[model samples]
Target: MKLGILGGTFNPVHTAHLRIAEEVRERCGLDRILFVPAATPPHKELAGAIPFADRYAMVAAAIADNPDFVATDLENRRAGKSYSVHTLELLHEEYPQDTFYFIIGMDSYRSLGIWKDFPRLFELANLVVAARPGIPCKDPLALLPVVIRDQFCYHESAHMLRHRSGNIVVFFEETYLDISSTQIRRLVSEGRSIRYLLPTAVEHYIYRHGLYHNDERF
Candidate 1:
């Protein structure tokens, strides 16, 4: 089985999120894409994120229509700061026979070395990075220590992750929706419309819960 792991805060699920999942599923021949919401990211702290339950609910609702896309609270359910390596380890254990491909943004991929047990993460599963339009592999190998640089290759697309080992695969897709949870909160706080920024259900949930009204950090 081939599983695609899309992990993020998902303070509010958006259409672009779904689009990326669909693209990966079809292009990468993935059997399933699990959307795992982060509990507390190691690099940054969430400021105005809606309650974890609410974020999880919105994610579930947004991906409910797609059988291939499912939401998992593995990171949120676990204690302490959420680390990719730990999550990958747990996922590997749960789906022993499945090939796990981690789907993430190119920005995250560039910072892989900064992550905890970065090399172990690659050993556990392939890393699939979704690069924004026109963004080159932002992280240069020259910046990394010699040993870690040797572990990765400047390759594009999920196919590289599937076919190659010891490297991160990047998939550059066109996504015009440059929206973020922080931006969404700002728009909502200013009484602006967020019709296309997120799913209708998620918008409704945010407004109904009065989230991000006073804070727009997350």
Candidate 2:
């Protein structure tokens, strides 16, 4: 089975998160998507993030009705900063039979070299990068390390790179909402309406718990 993994600091899971997962699942024929909420993401500062429990609950509530969506606590249960390489390694170990595809935005893919175990991550799971229309990534292939670059060959017919080991890099064009967690946090702090910006349950959960009412540096 092809499993899609989307990891992030879902301070409060929103509609956009669900949409992206659904889009990728349908576009790539994925069996299901597991939302892994980062307990402590190494790349982002966690100064203003809500409690891990709260974040986890919100993700669960947001995806409650979607049979294809699953909320996982893999990173949350682990100790220390949540690194993608470590997460992928553990996932590969536990689900040896499943083909893993990690969904990431183009912005994060640009900094792949900085990730833990950098190039080796390419071997653990296929990467599916979400790209907005009208803007192509600036020489993404050239940006990859020489060794990793050699692992894949672009197949013009599929518009994707087929890796030697069957781990591919699929460049998927998707319609992503402009909404962001950062923006949502800011809006809540300023008493602005977040209606339609997030799942109704998540929006209510944020307000009920005063998740980002004060909005300290996210």
Candidate 3:
């Protein structure tokens, strides 16, 4: 089985998140894409102190229509900070026979050097870095950490990097939706319409739970 893992805060899963998963699934021939909402993200704080259950529920609602997409509480179940390396390690142990593809946006890929055990990520799964709006990743290899750059051989034709661990890093250009979680939250806080920005279920969930309305940061 070919599984793709997309982990995020998902304060409220938006359409762009779903679209990215769909695009990567189709382009990479993935059987399923697991949406793992972080209970406590390691990098940044959750905007409104929204509970993990709410975030996870929104993710479930957003991807409910897609049979190929799944929502998992893998990060929620684990203790401490939600680190990508630990998540990948757990998944590898659980599905030893399956090939894993860790999906990430270009923005996140650029900051991967600071992630815990980031270099080991290539050993665990193939990376599919999808392009995001306003983030120009003209030379993906140049963005990689200098220490590990020599371990990968770039394939110009395929826009991929072959790591010594046998896993590959693919740069995928998917449909860019300018929508962002921050934008959605700001709109909701300002009492503006958040419709069409995300799945109807997710939009409704945010309102039903009264999230982001009191968030002063937005």
Candidate 4:
């Protein structure tokens, strides 16, 4: 089975998140897309101190109607910070026969160098870097971390890079929905309409729980 892993803080999973997962799943021929909400993201802080359970519930509700989409609490089960490398390693161990495609945005791809055990990520799974609005990654090779740059060879025709580990890194240009969790949260806090920005189920869940209602920052 080919699984696409989409990891995020998910403070509240928005429409773009679901669209990206679906786009990547179709583009990469993935059997399922795992929505792994980070328990404690290492890179940045959550917009508000929303509990992981609430975030996970929102993800579950957002993807409920889609049979191909699944919400997993793998990161939450782990003790420490939710690191992509660690999550990938765990996925490999648990599903040895399955192939994994680590789905990330172009912005994350540009900042890959700072991630823990980032080079090992190629060894664990193929990378699918989805293009984001305002983030241009025209030359994917040039953005690679210098230390591991030589480990991959670019195939211009295919627009992908093949790592020595046999895992490939591909760039994808999917339908761009400029909606963001930060924007949703901000809108909710100001008592504005958050309709259509996310799933109706998720919107209802957020309002029921009063999430982001008092947040001062976006």
Candidate 5:
């Protein structure tokens, strides 16, 4: 089985998040995509960040209609800070026969070196670096160590990822989404409507919970 992992804070899952997963599934020929919400993101930890359960619940609601998209609380359920390498290791052990693909943005790809146990992560799963608008694939050498830079596979779109490596390769998704959870949070905090920015269910959930309002970080 081919499984794609789309890990994020998902403080509130949006249409773009669902769209990216769908595109990746179709483009990468993935049997299913898992949305893993981070419990404690190492890089971006904000004060008054929404609780993990609320974020998980919102994600579950956003992707419930898509059979190919599923939600996982691995980070939330696990102890300690959430790290990609640890999650990938656990996933590989649990599904030895399955091939795992780690989906991430081009910007995130540029910062892979600073990630914890990044080298081990590459060995466990193929890294699918999704391109972003205005962000060119700069020198991987400058961004990452020589050993770590060797693990990347670039793809122009989700379509290209589907036909990769005779079923053994890291896929690159070229198409980029303009949406961001951080932007959504800012809009909400500014008393602006995010109707089109996110899934209807997610927007409703945010409003119902009154999140981002009291969140000073926003």
Candidate 6:
């Protein structure tokens, strides 16, 4: 089976997160899409980050109705700071027969080189980069640094980069809702309506836990 991995902080999983996964699965011909919430993200600010348990719960609640979607605790099951490369490596080892696709946004694609063991990540799975508003949707190879770009070659027929190591970067154009976890958190803090931004179950979960209340970074 082809697996699509969509990893994120998911401080609160929102509609866009679900939509992107759905689109990517359909476009990439993936049999399953796993939403892996990071236990401790390495690059982003975690000042007001929610606890791992709460974040994981929200992901589970958001994707509950979709049979094809799964909320995984892969990162939460591990110790220490989370790194994508390591996660992908373990996944490849465990599911040797599966073709894995690591999903990311265009913004993440631009900073791919700086990631820990980034070259090895490409070797483990194909990258499915979804375009978001304000982030350009272009040849992903061009966005990589010169050194990283040297490893990829655009296959005009495939419309994806065929890496020297047999890895491929699939640049997928998708219709994404302009919603963010940051914006939802800010609204909740301001006592504003967060309707339609995320699943109703997730909204209720946030309120019950008093999450992002005033954005105090507690």
Give me the candidate number with maximum lDDT: 4
- Give all TM-scores, in the order shown: 0.87, 0.94, 0.95, 0.97, 0.85, 0.93
What range of 10 consecutive residues in model 5 has the weakest lDDT sum? 159-168
Model 6 superposed RMSD (Cα) = 1.8
> Which lDDT value does model 6 have at 105?
86
Backbone clash pairs for candidate 4 read none
Candidate 1 global CA lDDT score? 0.76
**lDDT (10s digit) by residue, model 3, range 19-104:** 88999999999999999899889888789999999999999998888899999998888899999999999888878999999999
- Model 1, C-alpha of 96: deviation from truth (Å): 1.3
Q: Write the per-residue lDDT of candidate 4 for residues 1-218, one digit (tens) a residue.
A: 99999999998899999999999999999999999999999988887889999999999999999999999999999899999999999998888999999999887899999999999999999999998656556688999999999999999889899999999999978799989899999999999999999999999999999999999878
Task: Locate the minimum summed-lDDT window of 10 residues in model 2.
Answer: 136-145
User: For residues 26-126, what per-residue lDDT tens digits would candidate 5 score against the true structure?
Assistant: 88789999899999988887446689989999999898788888888888778988999999888887788999988887678667779998667656776
Q: What lDDT is obtained when candidate 4 is compared to the true structure?
A: 0.93
Stretches > 4 Å off in candidate 5? 133-143, 149-174
Model-by-model lDDT, in order? Answer: 0.76, 0.86, 0.90, 0.93, 0.76, 0.86
RMSD of 1: 2.9
Which of the two candidates, 1 or 3, achieves a greater lDDT against the reference?
Answer: 3
TM-score of the candidate numbered 6? 0.93
Name the regions of candidate 4 deviating beyond 4 angstroms.
133-136
What TM-score quantifies how close candidate 2 is to the native fold?
0.94
Whole-model alpha-carbon lDDT for candidate 2: 0.86
Candidate 6 regions with alpha-carbon error over 4 angstroms: 133-139
Q: Candidate 2, which segments miss by more than 4 Å at Cα?
A: none
